[model samples]
Target: MITTLRFTMLFAAALCAAGCGSDDEPAGSGTPGTGATTSSQASSGTGSGSSSGSGGSGSGGTGTGGDVTTTVVVNEISAKGSDWIELGNPGSAAADLGGFGLCDSDATGLCNTGDALRFPEGTELGPGEYLLVLGDQAVEVGPGPHTTCLAEGPSSCFYATWKVSASRGETVFLISPNDHVLNQLEYPMEAAADGQTWGRLPDLTGQGGVTAPTPGAANAAP
Candidate 1:
């Protein structure tokens, strides 16, 4: 009986050791398999970041638009009896002449003067339309299909306070609202005859020549 009891106790001790060893396992022996999944997840995160960066770069390439430029021209000038300057808009769109300036100078290029005559607010020149700016002593030279005027008071005539010399050649400048010179022309003293006017031959885009005084109408043949 004593031998059998000792054998049973030895068997029970061996079973308990086997069960405890299997339950404990090695601390991190199974972690290597899980590490592969973590690495795959890290790779996925990196790809996501790269895609986000690409989208950000695409959003930064949309700031290269075009700029607006003026197309109006100084079509005609008269330094005679009724000192007037004619501005024509041959473009397709109307031009807002408000805040635009006009100055008489002897400079061959752009004229910069502090006493420029600025167009009144709400002044506009429609497409293919002509605007006549008259001087204080200017009067309608002839009669035609031209009767629109922009004046401060209740008058049907638009008059300018500035005057151009009839004997001396001078440069006339058309300035934009931002103080940029739009167009300029230097008239000769010979072209400033009492009853004549210097204008673009074909209206807006032609060579300058002296013609009959057409205050608000198309230039006539010399």
Candidate 2:
């Protein structure tokens, strides 16, 4: 009877010990939460979004890269013989001169405008090239196709609206069609006279001075 009772006690102790043995690994040993994101998962999601956007159904013609803005400046001016205004391209690229504008004085608009001129269509200027604009009629030169003077230029001809005042020098303005001023200067009264011309000394860089005529060509020392 005593041996049987001891054997039953030992069996009960073994059952308790086996049930209490820990089966858990650790606190952080489980899988990640459903809301958590890994770095690789984030990268993969971004790549998929980009790919889906590129696969959208949209079409268009080839792109021209939009309008290119190039540098074209006033190279020379002449209030004397033929009354020519010269433009120079000092840059290394070709520029479209279409829709460029000029004015003898500051032009507010068409009503109170001084002598203003506009370049004809299809006008172009190349690298290191020169352009000459002449005054023929004694009237104001409005925008394109409104001038009376014919273009005698190789590339294109632009005519001044009114004769440049040699006696009463006024402001000379070079503007784009969008009313953007490219170059402007105040021509002092009697800036050039007696067949002498007012122009840029070294073509594109030097200061303005009275020099010999170099219409449609490089400027030289007077």
RMSD of every candidate to native, in Å, equals: 23.2, 19.7
Q: Lowest summed-lDDT stretch of 10 residues in model 2?
A: 40-49
TM-score per candidate: 0.57, 0.56
Superposition error at 201 for model 2 (Å):
1.8
State the displacement of the C-alpha of residue 53, model 2, in Å, after optimal TM-score superposition: 47
TM-score of 2: 0.56
The ten-residue window of minimal lDDT in model 1 covers: 38-47
lDDT computed for candidate 2:
0.54
Candidate 1 Cα outliers beyond 4 Å, as residue runs:
1-68, 106-112, 136-157
